[model samples]
Target: MFDGMVKIVLAGPVGAGKTTTLRSLSDDEPVSTEMPLTDGPMGEKTTTTVALDFSTVMLDDGTPLQMFGLPGQDHFAHMRPIILQGALGVIVLLAADQPDILTMCSEWLDAIQSITPDTPIAIGITRSDQARDFRMDALRALLAERKTTLPVFTIDARDREQAQQLVRALVYSFA
Candidate 1:
């Protein structure tokens, strides 16, 4: 289903778990350009990715996958297409606790798809345990309204298995 290194991009708004997802899935310690969040406090987050978060993970079949996580903040929006270039797939993570979770997902989805149209895209909803009123079905419905249906996973980005699932699902999606 793949040749050479497979590249996938993780994208979403700040505090959406892009960094943690890359960290948990990386086989080796990922190299990240995380700088202190001087702008302000983002919940428990004191650091943020200014450029990109990168790592490599080997699939069970020995295919090396290059993971590139984009900086989620809009100020760094320029990096989105740079990181997304040549990506075979994308996974957009959104925090379920955000009031605009659905809109955020829609925007990220539309943005990425517009940038890398025809690229297989999946979604991972992070911070599910923190959600009080977020609805997954509503998210699904919104995608349906957008004429897009994709694999959606509610994940704790710190968990290797859950994060890995999103990556693997994306890889197989190309097959």
Candidate 2:
């Protein structure tokens, strides 16, 4: 580990578990920047991440990682470039059931490529436990079609242990 901290970002589509991922890895409950979700079929009661969700984790060598989660909606896309600033890498979350997860991945890849082209990336295959009808092999093949070799694995955002392991792997890619 290095002497200073490494910053990482978590990005994905709506319902891909960005909030849950932040909650799972942070030493304490993650702090988020929320805005009201007042559009679409849902009424004005829903709140979404408007800015970013940030948390820090300390490695065994005392190096800290600042993890940030970007807002999933297109309205928040303008902030993507700023949020990725100073980031060491990214962990992209994807729901296995979402057929368009690949498109989301491509968008994220394009958005971050200029900042850190070779940045280590880890893909968290969220909702794997509930994806009863899909095969993991098929999911891997789908990812391969995008020209990305992200290390994909099951992650339960509610489980701290599982989430921590996934973050560790993402960090190790850069360590």
lDDT of each: 0.88, 0.77
Give the range of the ten consecutive residues with the poorest summed lDDT in model 2.
Answer: 37-46
> Model 1, 39-145: lDDT tens per residue?
87887999999999999877788788899999988889888888888888999999999999888988898789888998999899988886878788999899899
lDDT of 2 by residue, 40-112 (tens): 4332226778888998888788788788999888888888888877778788887766766666667766777
The TM-score obtained by model 2 is 0.82
Q: In model 1, what lDDT does residue 158 have?
A: 96
Candidate 1 error regions (>4 Å) = 1-5, 59-63, 172-175
Query: What TM-score quantifies how close candidate 1 is to the native fold?
Result: 0.92
lDDT of 1: 0.88
- The weakest ten consecutive residues by lDDT in model 1 span 1-10
Give the number of the best model, judged by lDDT.
1
TM-score each candidate.
0.92, 0.82
